[model samples]
Target: MEGFQIIRWLSSDDTAAVYEAAGPRGRRLIYTVGHRPAEPAAEFSAWAERLRGVRHPHLAAVAAAGLTDDARPYVLCDTGSTTLAERLVHTPPGVNEVVRTTTAIADALDTAHAAGLRHGTVCPSTVVYAADGTPQLTGFDMCAPALVKTARPGLYTAPEADPGPPADVYALAATAYVALGGTLPYVGDPTDPALRLRGITELPGVPPELTGMLRTALNPDPVSRPSAALLRDALSTVEVPETVTTGALPVAVVGSDVRAVSSGMTTIIEAVTGEQPRIGREKSPPMPPGLAPTRPLPVAPPAPKPVRAKPVTSKPAKASGRRTGRRIGVAVVVLAVIAAGIGGVWLWRDQFAEATEGSSAIERVDFNAIEFTVPADNDRKVTLTGGSATSTNDDGRAESWTLTDGPVFADGNHNGDQDTAAIHLVLEVRGSKRSYVLLFTWDGRPKQAQQVVNGVCDVTDMRSAGPGIELDLVSANPFADCSALGKGDTRAETITVAMRGGFLMETAPHEGATSRCELAPGAETRAQDGDLPVRVAADAGAPELAEDIDSVTVFLPETAGQIQWHLARVTLADGTTTCGWVAAADL
Candidate 1:
């Protein structure tokens, strides 16, 4: 501080002044100090020392710090030409420029946090623009206590400091907001001292991605904000490309005129003059692979020559000269007539040749137009064959058939449900690989259908079943009723079954009491019987039961009710049993 001299005043309100200082080698560097009268001299000295330890591309490097001659405390840092605020006001910066500046500031905060320091003050004015237009952070007088505790008017202060990371995040976000257009999201004047002190906590207008990030940074709860390193990582993902605006072209010409011309005219002019014309019509110069064409120049036309005619001579001899002149004139007339006749015939023949050539060119046409029309209905019908069916015995009997040569279908509406009518059937079989699908009419009600190939039901595979014959469910919401229809062993014998139509049914509860219930494959319950598990008789014929019957899970309330069980002994026979239970408060 003793070897420093004030060269210029940067700002009166913030008491930022530029000074020149000589180091041990007599090398002079511009040093800046914030002249805050409110800060004690000793506290300011300590804050400057803390900042001096921080090194980053964005933050101004601190050279020295101490009490001035008049008992005033000052924090010395690298002095630069302008502030980011001044740059924004004077020169238009692109999004890339803004991103570069903001990233620098973020890096500075990272370095400060690493050095056990936090920038208490972060605002547009605090960011100084270097001579090369790079923005650097300055002013560390208010950096004591690690983070800002009390609200400083017109300065962006974090919610809490307490030597934590969140405070730094808030300051970084404030700097970023200023870098990107400097407009607050909320309805308030950003320049107002009261509003600025309040900080940009709620920026709903910011992009959702940026808003989410800044929200974390500006979290009122310091514990929620990310650390400086984490903030830098987050900023890395921000796609801060060059700013785009209507008419935000790079070159700034105060008064410029632009015009358009036809490509045909441009080509003709360019050909005749050998000069490349403007308006992007100049023929590209022959270029080697990967090389670009050089800018074309206009060609100059040949200068015209001045002509001088021979003087006419007056006739001298009268008689002999007159007779000779008449003979010569007659001969010239005869030769002119003959030449005119030949030229006429030649012109007529040339016209005829052109016409013939034009007609012949039509016959040798190089291209033809082809048109295609889709039928209004756009409906197709298809039938598929060749599938195998197998039966399984769990607590109950169940059967499964799988097919793998049908067309793939989609809901089209993306509602996570399947459309049965949209199901296209396999048409004219080209080969095993390609299966044609036919479109059906859409019914108002929800229809369930599957693109049945050879007979293997496609369902979600939790594990690796094998290669080439995997069963998977295309729909996110698989049918609860159809869950058990895909489990079975593949046998050699083929089984044929037609689509028997599908309908939605309310699942019956296994217990008599009404409660939440689930169905397991190869399990069924009788409507008449209570909650009793019935065993099927081996001698009884098979009952005509649903295709997939898993175990029925019933949530029973503690209420007195009758429960029923159905036992399917065979394909066409069934027996029922009933029981009763009382609902208990605690079961």
Candidate 2:
């Protein structure tokens, strides 16, 4: 309502609140805000600036974004009546609708991606239908945390694994899978970090014609996925080939030109992001510990007070009548006991359900507390340099590492070639707990590792990521020559480099960047380190919101300091404090 005319409140999540409104041009648009408090000022500016650079028919236009006098961040965009998500919930779309929607979105994605942009989160909800049934996408240029706030987790690809076209294609194809198959691409629980472990293994049951297209888009390596234009163009023709045209960007033709475009886009992205390019997932900064959800949690209802039995009275006249009274009293007691048992069961079920759904189910990864690695190849003929090193955190804190001893090289099976890698391991460590690792591999030539995980240079932790590690074997191995197409000739059986200990995340502090927090239910009340109760949503149902709350019970996992992660929060009586298992995800 700042400058637009409000029509009605539409919907909201922990990260944003949406409303229908009339723009200054008399056209309609959706207004969204980082409604949660203590959001980063820098992040808002970055998201807004990127939004300004994007324009497409399929993409919902960003009409406006800015800070209010109170410093609330808001964004206004084109609105649509029914999102693919909402529509599917009521009735699944026909094949024709699915094709048309996917085509339009691909065209939009191609335009944005070619210009070096990505709709970090592309799911059914973002693609809404207009009054005329035309589809348009909202929530462009959203960051990781915001996307997590809005998106259905486990549906989107983890960016740390594969950024760029590959990840975007996977999301689009996944959306198509949901639209056509009436379910997500991967059927298991979306919250489980290990859910999509195999990476598009068993393709979703789709038309025989569309299978190859989806597979190509869903390749584990970004380098292998076809461009949005290529895939969309291939799908348009009635006669599609097993392999489409322009598979590898014609590394021959667009080689230099592609690099130029990618380079410029990279420069702009780096400037705005101030972090390495996360492959697929959105990166949300962590909120301070103990803050109430910017979005309120569903507080537990007051415990049903036990009903006390009424006292029996003795005012008998005859002996027979007294015997009858005793029998009647026993029946009353039995009936009361049954009623109490039923009430207890009902209360337990209500509390159990509330404790598992919505933000109550989400887990937060603390980026600050974890450590990561920065690896490099000691190019001195099989030498791996920067093995053991120490780096400073954003707050000028120090992190130490145990690196591979100097000249760490193993002999290769092929002609005594040195076997080593030019990878900088950026690991996120949580004490002795498992650490998340990303491999930064550079060989002065484009390769799979860079395409797969964006070389993992900037992230302290990846979005929706569980515990795992990656290695960029392009530079370190001595067996393979510096050929663009032929590297890493040393097969794993050839040799191995010994290492001690593990990794953590870090980046040199930005000059002007200030710290920011994630979306909170309210002014944050950091829960003390212990048990925090939150609801975990099932794979099918919508996560419910809290209508009212007396107080909140936050269940934080041991990963609190590792990834700025937070589980969903649960509401309880104002003074109620306790812990117990209500729901769980398949780890």
Candidate 3:
């Protein structure tokens, strides 16, 4: 290790090698070497660089990261002597311990999420307890495409697409379930995404409220999962019986954060091979036009390995059986097509917009081929051909509008099918611009249906919200000056848009209710009902954590018992301040 002494190797798997290492100043640290990808070292370094700035007390900070002499990606991080996985093997965590530990982890995750980072490999292995017994999260930014394989790394992975923030929630919930002594929900082939989506088995002895929250976190639809901050709040309110904390293992240990390489890793390698189909094999029916194959065939079928309830250990995990064979000869033909570049889209679109039969044309249409119209000066409209348009003003100042995302299909037309497509476009002018959501309908071709401008903010993500569209918006602390907002400044909020009376409009709050405010952290507001108490927890029955509040500065807003509550720092009448949950109705 670079300038570090490897005390001993803790674990070695096909995915990574974990070791107890001594870093600068003899600081005990855990070093990891994950399976290298074909991509350049700079790409891995870039991600590691990003993780360096994401700091939290509960997050294991990346001390150093780079490639080894052999080009394997390695990271040195702060950690405790043992991992959550090792602790679980002995004593299952009591309900109270699960809430406290998971809440801390979720809060830590929320901090990273706010900075636009994701802990793609969250699991028992990544959650390591500190010397004082507080868990700290490790393995940030380790889920490179090549490393993401079957569900075997840990049984707690999101089933839908590549791991994202929502996936992290699912992983945390699964980890908590296991800590509470629940059986691993997944069975059958480790590489199957369908197994992850089979729904979690009920956890005996768990509080109903906690179980319900976990159910939502494990929903097959990622969009429906709550944010890390929301989950933390909900978990805090869970009434778990207070019990003695479990004892730690005497010997030191830590688990690898990277997913172990297995059958799925080979699937990636096979996709790019140049092998040809054997001659004289029985012919199979051809795929319909416009549809593309998701994966290519392996050069050879791998031997089957029995499923095991193995926590990612110090040994290399065995590869599962070759993906249920698809007529051996037929696989060779598909691989040949991939080898010839005819299926180039398969490389990136493996999980992009999976449009199945009976889906609307909007789901399958080529967004790049559609032309659009954008606003220009003096009520003029600039026709954008090929997804972008640029114009020069009389003063010779160049302005441009380019499509950034979308073709997001939703049933905005009141029809049974999701025929309306929403595309996102960004304007670059004088370093001050906003995004627009352009809605289009297909009548033999894409036709403009409606257009809506996003409030002066950055669009981080967009997805269908029933018959509407939900946009995750991010802005700087002082949002009034959008130009000052740099890439790393990350205060954010979400908004939804829907079609009302043949026009796309921002969805309003229910009649007598107010929507969550887009207030910056520490934004001050006055309390309306001073008599109402601010509780220590989100639940109404929880003890008051703050007293004699004069005013409050709110951070995050959430709902409990159909009432809105703001997690706020309350200023007392005597000039002292403390943080607690303040009801929206009281504020």
Candidate 4:
């Protein structure tokens, strides 16, 4: 009799026995007692023959199969030291590991599908990892039907549905769900695949990056599920970045698979890449520039997402014109799908935004003018009431404010470039719901909050600084004197400031409009140089000016160029400051 030693029984059920055994050659093997399907498919025998010859790193290799003396069929397959289910019982896999495993399983299944085979049964318990952690799938032709006593419904789809490709995807998602969330997706009838799907809906959510894919995979209707490869791709896209720059608007979909939510973005994306965002069954490849939706997506019906046969080791190649046209067609589908579906980049974005930004509300409003009043110069209490113009609050509330004077151009405390103008808003913020109009500068720094107060005169403007952005409330209306101008003195003012390249150089607040350069050095009105000679300017009239270069550096020693200030605000390397109007005809 051929002899092999049975070292130990690993697990057992009425239908099968898993044992650790040493072969006659002394090679270790996993021996199972079941081969005859309890309810085999029509092609069971042929499929078994094919599976026996097919080999893959992720699938267990069939060592041998035979009929025992008791007339029970048995199959022996190569396996790792432990199964995924066994290891997870003792220690939980981190979310990253779960992602890796999910990708590996998908790759294997996709490979199997290409070979005209399906896992039929894919679950955590059926996948064993080598001592080196490479997963080997064991259940292929072994997938039990409704009549089979040995099957894990907690990790599989219903047998009644034949649990096709999407079923395997569902199982992989369930496994990922358990790993990342640290809990089973469903707990009730572990044998009923239908009930399990229902239970999945009630379980705690997975990591957001995976939530949408899992939800779709877990759908009871197989038609609703995305393929395993697409599920893998979805998971791959969901990494929470370590850091995001401050003040950057939520532009790209922070963590989602959808390229864009609005149709407008699709146009921009197509214009940039000459390709559109593909959606539904065949989503287009990523455009050259990475644009993603910021919304959380739901289980979208299968869009023809391209399945990669080889591992995604390199960046995707640029789309061909043919592919681009196909992508454009897919984009057209996206607009239609978006209407029918309640998910994708927008949903993911909303979920993520809520998480990162919380429910705090701070809004911005830009108006020509807003006027606030302070009864006393030192009085912190203020009231906003001035001219009549219209605007809308963040909450879409109708409000009005007026500009009593010009938008003044001042560097304030020398924080911003003096060339950038600041406005003097003197209009009454008129929203009954808004008792006080919160004032913030162009950069969103709270300038001054306008409120109500009365009592004294000589009102002075003030500013406050904090760890974050500073706040300032510039005063608009100025009076001649208490005796000359008493209470309710109405002043008509128009605000305009001359700005060069967004910098407020000077503000003609007195004229109630912005005009001219404020730095005219009264003595003779000239120009000088700054410490660093980055720029140069010249008088409108200088002989041979037409022949001179557009701009040049005089400090470089031999040039026709410009000036910064008439005052010695800029010192040279020799510790001497330079002033101007020397009037070099050509230098």
Which candidate leads in lDDT? 3
Question: lDDT tens string, model 1, 96-137?
Answer: 566566667777777877776765556554666654567787
Model 4's TM-score against the true structure: 0.36
The residue ranges of model 2 lying beyond 4 angstroms of the native Cα positions read 1-3, 10-12, 24-26, 36-43, 144-152, 158-164, 182-185, 191-207, 238-587
Q: How accurate is candidate 3 locally (lDDT)?
A: 0.50
Flag the better candidate by lDDT, 1 or 3. 3
Model 4: lDDT of residue 464: 16
Superposed model 1: Cα runs more than 4 Å off: 1-5, 10-46, 69-71, 145-151, 159-165, 186-208, 243-587
**What is the C-alpha local distance difference test score of each model?**
0.32, 0.36, 0.50, 0.35
For TM-score, the strongest prediction is 3
The predictions' CA RMSDs to the true structure, in order, are: 40.6, 29.3, 26.5, 29.3
lDDT of 3 by residue, 313-341 (tens): 10000111111111111000000100111
In terms of lDDT, model 4 sits at 0.35
TM-scores, each model vs. reference: 0.34, 0.37, 0.40, 0.36
